[model samples]
Target: MSTSRAPPVFLLVLLPFFASTAFISSVNGAAHMTPETSAICPTCPYFLPTPREVTTPEGIPANLTCGVRLLADRKVSWIRRKDLHVLTTGDFTYTTANKFRALHLPGSPYWSLQVEKPTVDDSGIYECQVSTQPKIFRRFTLNVVVPSAAITGTREMFMKAGSDINITCIVKGAIRGAPVTWYHVLPRPPYTEEEVEEINAGGRGGVQVVTDKHAGTSWLLVTHATWRDAGNYTCAPVHATPATVSVHVLDEEVPAGLHHDLHPSEGRSSITSPPCSTLLTVLLLVLQRVAAVNEHGHWCSFCLLLGITSCLSLTAVYTAAGETWTAAQDLSSTWSVWRL
Candidate 1:
């Protein structure tokens, strides 16, 4: 049976391998291995190869291309994580970014996503959706975390004293709602030490938040950003395992303490109280340089940084309603974009 594939459709189909625990797959003797691991199919698993983080070799542009050449009888589609907007399907394309385009290797069994000059706005969980009688699917997280002098969370500013300094937590993996709290690492008299609690003219709860998902890009929104709001903010999700980003909002915009720390574009690092993915995983992969692995036998840093990471070599497992695959991970490094 010649298992090849037609042009791929964007369906936000995620390969369950990466989102879950690390699963090891031994690579066979093949030259064009999309990733370190190949599909365990006698025929073809036309999923794409995705890397957590790739230090583009200088001139090398950023793109997420599935390094496979397979024939899949199923159809594919891509949806926006925010509004569930279908970007591409079969021969149709709908994104405004000209840098974005799909392809099919003639005589080859592979499909890929090509982003021209990927920007921060281009980070999110992209589902490689496949549809069939009883479909088989996979996932890839295209982490377009371009280097920034000030790499903060999604960034949202609000009123301060008059409003609740809402600090939200960014989630990773599958954590829906964990724990959302605020920390004053700066100078605080302690929760009780404050003899005078300034009453905000808002509502009963000074600050309240609304979480969406754990994959889309999000950051805390301080109702009123001010010198008093300057401090460390964190949101811990139900996953509990550790996946949060400490957003340091300064009164005068101080440099992030952990200047060298890398933040994930999607849930690759932190989870929100809930809500956020589809293209490109719609997330970013934070590469932590930990000294050693932990007792759980998992990488220590994944848990330490309040961010948990599971290593997988692209094990295709689609769990969504309508999704499929081609060799892909997530994060567009090979994709090309000229930027506006």
Candidate 2:
């Protein structure tokens, strides 16, 4: 049994070195993967650290923020996706439009592109780009929603004269307690700008503007509705789309055609009369029949009276003779002759 040989020296020496090297490489790789280590790296600037969507109201400024890390020699800019228009570049500079500016907040590592007084025209996709070696970018969508004022009542309202008119104006996507103004626009189309201007300044006669504001809504009360008040009323708020409603005042005197009982399907009402000659003939026939029946009854009664009186006198004589007599035949014959 013999002597066991030792392992090879080269293999024994290389195995430990390889194991140590693998352990060191794994540690270094893990460190590089960490967020803190990634932030310290100068070349990689994280563009966005928040949500990629932004919504703003019309006529208000919108600020889209971008995260910049160690961007000393790098250039940051905003580009519109629809037109590829460069809006802002670097810090405190605008590249395309006058209303856009790129500014850095004090003591912060963030850059913002300010869109002043943005409107629906400004709604689109935007990109924040970093001028790195490989060109890094982040996308954002901007939606400019216009706050609107809507009248909740029917578009055309029916009201009798001398009645109260109340209209509700609901504000959607507006700040709470926003003021809504009511205007009485002319009923006819093609209203002049001068007339609108005058109404905006102060209403004319028969036009009263009363507004009460509540949670995201406004109530307009017009007292004593009249013919002159029949027109288009608009609920308008500052820098928002206005809503319109039509007021129709009913006349005091109803139409002659509609004076009768109203039929659901028919617009007007009417009464039908039977033929005059037909009704008169029916009435005359009924009267003649009643007179004939009365005359026949009188004749029958006279016959009965004669038969009874004569029978009673004859019955006294028959009783004296002790004779039984029945007057059935005599009474029947007498009545029949009198009827003829």
Question: Which regions of candidate 1 are displaced past 4 Å?
Answer: 1-61, 67-72, 146-340
lDDT of 1 by residue, 148-212 (tens): 11214455332333344544444443223333332233324334232222222353333444556
TM-score of 1: 0.28
Off by over 4 Å in 2: 1-44, 47-51, 57-59, 69-73, 92-94, 117-119, 132-135, 145-148, 161-164, 171-178, 185-216, 221-230, 251-340
TM-score of each: 0.28, 0.47
Overall local distance difference test of candidate 1: 0.39
lDDT of 1 at 41: 28
Best by TM-score: 2
Which candidate comes out best when scored by lDDT? 2
For residue 299, what is the lDDT in candidate 2? Answer: 57
